[model samples]
Target: MAPVTSGSTRTRSTASHPGHPDLAAYRARELGRVRFRRALTLLVMTLLMPGSAQLVMGRKQVGRLAVRVWLACVGSALLLAAVGWLWPEVLFRLAADTTVLAVLRTGLTVLAIGWTLLLIDAWRLGDPLRLRQKQRLAMVGLNGTVVFAVAGSLLFASHLVAVQRDFITTMFGDGVASAAEHGRYNVLLIGGDAGDGRWGLRTDSMTVASIDEETGRTILFGLPRNMTNFPFPEGSELAAEFPDGYDCETCTLNSLATWAADHRDLFKGSETPGIDATIEGIEGITGLKINYYTLVNMEGFKSLVTAMGGLTLNVRDRIPIGVPVVDYIEPGVRRLNGFQTLWFARSRESADDYSRMARQKCVMSAMLQQLSPQTVLTKFEALADASTHLIETDLPASEVGEFTQLALRAKSQKVGTVSFVPPAINTSDPDIDKIRTMIDDAITKSEQPSGSGRKKGPGFSKSSSGASTGGSIGSLSSGYAANQSADLSKVC
Candidate 1:
């Protein structure tokens, strides 16, 4: 061997002997750099493959299990995304299902905890204590940042799921589901207030939103609150009492709720006697089977508008603020706040009930058009809170997912409206048979293909010859544009 020694071998052996101070220092520096690179590589592997770091430098069994779980989770997510893209209803169903929400919440919480632990283990495998001071600090910083960021996001998602579940459970009831009648769902919408000296909440404004079961085309049948001599369903309690029609001076449609509340015995086993009685009245008038009823508290509704960041309305005229006219909401296309909107929808100091009804319809149209899914998601918590206080309904929670889908569909279509006010049908003595026929005709027309024998209303024309009756775009006798328009948006 001594005879066969080459120049290169002799130089390497001299360097290995550590007799040369500079050579030994160079070797130490190279070794440190190699260790640093190895530690950095393990951290990168942990980030990219979750358990690959453990497989190479830590427990092999743990690494295999972690990698398998990570793969399964990723695969399941991709599958769900694909399915959701193909059929969006499935996603809505999952979102609405309480059991699904609970499972999701639990899974998110578990993933947060599990992923944090895995990251900690990966950091430990990197052996940061053996790393140089700067490298160790860098690894610690990176691990902590990644752990908190991922865990925080998961935890936040879980919290949102929990909030939605609670909102659904608390807001909706376990009421019996009502089937759609004549291929349409007639939901009675009542807007009113429960003030002092009132027997119950007054049915100030009432409209039956008859929506097509399949197409979601809706026709709003605005029944005047002062409608008198209206017969109820023949077999109902109110019908028996008002067999000759509610023909007294105080026996108007709006007064029916108070009348029913005063005599609760008439509505036995009913939670909302006023609303149920009002629904019967509406059914008796429109001849449409009521599927459900949503009673909105006028006072609390202001909060909902505020939550939506106010509603943009075309205020045609100056609307008085208070009953005695304290302030005025200036005209033009303006974004009105909650207070102004409530006043715009409810104030009748100088306006007739019909004009107010027209404004309300405009408000509804604006809300439908402007309240996008993105807006709802962004302002969900605020909207949810306001809704709980604003609305009361017999709509079952089981049907929420379906109704949500219908609403989305409704948003895409034009809303047809029919109001049974003066000149068309006298509120004091409305012709029941004629009103029913008109409703049936409207529904039939709405179900037809767009632009097929359907007349569009004069939408928001400022230069029209029509008189501006109480800030609305038409005279009471001629009919407010919003009240009887094919597209309410035109008038608004």
Candidate 2:
């Protein structure tokens, strides 16, 4: 109603509202809020899809390059893993390369740095001043944690790979492995003792682990230390030396090491003359070609078992540790420590060597079942260190990958065993023909799938009359029930 006057004029500031903040100030506040939201969105995007933030926001060109590199990294990793599983030779060769290891260390470092920077940059693009102080700190803490976890995981994995590679390289070196014979890889396992008062490197235990390459089903041919008249493979150096089998009355199956050590000249150009000669003798006994040999130190065997966290054995009877300390591992489902386990597998005072052999087989089965991947990873360093002193093998580093794959496969199936001792055959004068027949039949039956008329549930075939059946083995007191079955776990 009052007339407008210049002195007392009423002025409108913005179209939206009068007497409010200036347009510029309001615009600034809105921009701040929008930027904070963008920053939040950018972080979430980067976390979900690496490089996506740069792809959609900051720099299109950089985002595209980052995306491509990320894809390549993923693809290459998957390919390497697949190859490692299929043909471990590739992995073995790569592991042997110092240059590759350096590259891996450097690449992981670069990725860790670059990844962290990108994540931090994504948060920076979010424009933190717009966010509350608490929100900004929270983001910083979360991103820091993520960076540490990712980087640490990559670095640790790299270190483990290197350690395992070094162990394989140092242990196996460059020895060439023999080809699989008749679709099988037969490795000679020898337990050697060279402590004080003992003859030089006398082999106390011998077992042939013959694995089928395809199915991974195994047949363990146990040769007694007292076995005599076992013929050597024809044309082999040992055979040429001992024309009528290794028939020294005092020097039987376990005496090969001392003899070979004494006559290294006979085994010319042999790195491990003792082990090689012993292998030839085993080949003769089992009628199977020996692919490789593993010599385990008996004294150090305790440390090896301890490193594996001990073994669980179904003790059939009271077993003595030995002379000075007459410690007996009592019966029932029990866990045995290093000292106790060694005696359980090797002691022969109360019982003869034949009984010791069966107990050893059960010990082997327990070790095979318990050495899982988790156990290896957790005790990786200990196991590797133990092996350096405890085991000596002719297995090649290059072929380790293949055998590793085979071993992994073997873990899932039933293990078949044929101990050529006692009631099954006469050890003092074993029928060489019958020994060969037993091994051949075991292998043949193993090749057939489970429940096939030829192969029952981890036991000898009902059809094969001469086969080492569980029923026939009952002639003994404890009964050779535990060791002579295809399924050692069930009997043990």
Candidate 3:
């Protein structure tokens, strides 16, 4: 064969030989390309289907277990979403339950850890040691990024869940539940201040919020601080002390708190004697059985408003910031900070107590209307912290979920109000019969359908003869618009 071999035949033989340098180089290049493709495929599979990479790369048992768990988690999430959409109250109840929250937090933590380990295993299955330097570096970067992102999100969610649990446990207590009376819940709201030398808090503002149990329709019965000669419930300790009524010259409605505090023996074993006594007096005056009481600390209220990022109010007149008029909140529709709002609600400079009460009503309306869900989520932590200090209540923690749902329902409807001020009733000696009649009528009207003979309140009507007082739309003599309006939003 060597004697007469053709040149073309010789060349072909050389190319086919395993020992040839050119052939060896070409095979090496092909092998490198295959390894790179394999590495890329494994990473992509792990990203799309968490355990797929391990299944294909020889960890069948681990891969099967992970895939099954992932499917179960997805299915459970879909199921929960479906149930929540159908029954919103169920979700609220679950959210308010401490045990459920603790379970959720633990589940989230476990999920985060499990997901991270799976991602790391997927990277290991890619065989980084055999990959080219550039390919190995790229895979490591991508894998780390995904692991941190997923794990970080889950951990953050767990933290928020823990925060909510803590807030609920700390702020609310295991108080006895009070049943609704006559298809309604009458809650007493007291705005109090404990200044120097005060025996206890003096209630500057008081309102009985009578709400429909089913509809959440509300009517606010505002009691003046200067009101006198109001009766207490027949069987209450206060009534035994003053059989006729609280008729002494200095025995105004506001003084009851101090008196109750000084003589706590009357309210034996009671943590809040002042509030208990006030509730009894309110029940007799309004002829409604009070279900619960919420006392708001005036100083702590500033912190709450600040946490909410201030409130927008219609400033009808210039309000002095402090006594002797150091500074003034000028009139106009304006956004007021916590300090300014406190002054707006509390200031009585050049303004009577009735005028101050009117301003307080406006502030309450503005807070309710402006507090949106988005704001709550954004400032949830601050709001929770402030609320614990701001409010003291006998409302049961178990009822929080229900009341929360009710409050949301109330936001959509008009709020009716009836204040016992000036021309309506004499503060020195209020007509108990007339006051009760007004409260009954207001509640009856509020319970009616929106347009079914439901009369609207006298809202923001200028006094034809009297002038505006204390930055309110109406005068004390004519009745402040915000104090007795059917729709508080319209007047405020």
Candidate 4:
């Protein structure tokens, strides 16, 4: 079969010879027209974008696209700048620096580079459609990034303050010191059954420890809860000043709770049973002006201990029998979980609150020791978690940091622990005056001038003449006994 030329080919053969110059010229013109139209579109689109510099007349499509991209870039840049200015933290945390300013600068740099590249791409592409697509994608990504940054910044700002506040609460807790002596800190470490249904509320154990970091000395005085004396300050005028409902009288400070419980009329106006008056009474008893006071209900203690991990304690003697619900703690060093520690603190069947108070002090001392840098680093994550849940205080976070720094600087510093128990200072009968004297002496001794050492000395020391022999533990009834014999090394 012969290969046939189509009818159009035959007509072309007739009209013009195969090597015609005019036909070649016509084909070149058509291709040129198409390219020109595309370039024009690019130019027009470029003009639509911000900054007409990219939209040259020749390449309409490419120029127009370049203009559109430039506009998008400019818009995104402005938005990012505003975000950085308004919510620096958005950039800060993403950049992850303690310094806020540094993070913002870094975010701005990233935004500028990213937008500049998008603008360049729009100019290179001659097709308006392609340019528009790229610009839209860039805009979406940029806007989304800024939105996430803003949200993150807000959350970061909120958490920053919260974390610091939590740290401060752990340090200066309860803000007991007055502004005049703001530098002076006092911890009224109390051991008590706080109105649990099983037992009425009363301060079972009280130890007023004064910390004069300025002088580098701490005075710890143990006050028996059962002592009978001028409970509501010593003077009659001061007693009269209290709420009339309390029925002002000289009685055992420990009895304040029992009395208040019996006479609910006294606490009618108050939500927190006579705490204010009780604080006043405490200051009067010790004659040491109190600046801050904190009342911790039972729940707070257990949570706090658990957060710090189980506390470490040196068991002085065999727990003998277990307090119901809580197990028997064997004699020796024991790592106690939160529930165990609380049970150990509250167990009065085998020992009185006086002994309990000593145990609490021992636990506190152990806690301080465990809070060292070595311990902190070992369980930093847990410590941080526990800290947030278990504390309330007025001291600022910065101050807490300062204290931590101070503590860390003196790595070799010694923390002395004492419990005022049997044989240290006897309280056979409710001798309020005698107890007061002992507390005063302990505070005075702690604050007394010392050499390189800043810790509290031995709780009780015999004078040169030596006093009369003290009575045996069996003879003492309802008398105060403390674990004054201290092995000071365990404390921080």
Q: What is the TM-score of each candidate against the true structure?
A: 0.89, 0.79, 0.87, 0.52
- In angstroms, how far off is 386's CA in candidate 3? 1.2
Candidate 4 per-residue lDDT, tens place, 443-470, comes to 5555554456523322121221211112
lDDT of 1 at 160: 85
Candidate 1 residues lying further than 4 Å off, grouped into runs, are: 1-49, 194-200, 451-467
Clashing pairs in 3: none
For 1-492, candidate 2 gives per-residue lDDT tens digits of 986666324334243464456766777677766666777788877766668898787578777777777788889899999998897757756765555766786677777667777787787777676676766777778777877786677777677767776677678867676899999999988888748744336889899999988766777788888888778888988889889877776758888877888898998887777888788888888778888888888878888889988877667667777775477787656777888888888877666666677778877877876777688889888888899878888888767767776776677778877888878778778898998998888888888778522222222112222212212223354447544776665655
Sort by lDDT, best first. Answer: 1, 3, 2, 4
Error of 1 at 310 (Å): 2.0
**Residue 94, candidate 2: how far off, in angstroms?**
8.3
Error of 1 at 24 (Å): 6.5
**What is the lDDT, from 0 to 100, of the residue 70 in candidate 1?**
86
Q: lDDT (CA) for every model shown?
A: 0.83, 0.74, 0.81, 0.49
Q: Candidate 1 lDDT, tens digit per residue, 1-492?
A: 457889999888887775787697897778767777877787678767778888987589989988998899899899889977897678777888888999999999998887888888877877778777888888889888988888999998898899899988888888788999888998988888645644236987898998988877888989998899888888999888878888997888898888888899988998778888888888888888989988888877889999999988878878888868899888887888999999999888788888999999988888876778888988888899899877888888888987888887788778999999977998888899999888878888898799542233322333443557777988876888888878777676
Task: Order the candidates by TM-score, highest first.
Answer: 1, 3, 2, 4
- Worst lDDT 10-window in candidate 4: 466-475
What value does the lDDT take at residue 187 in candidate 4?
57
- C-alpha lDDT (0 to 100) for residue 354 of candidate 3: 85
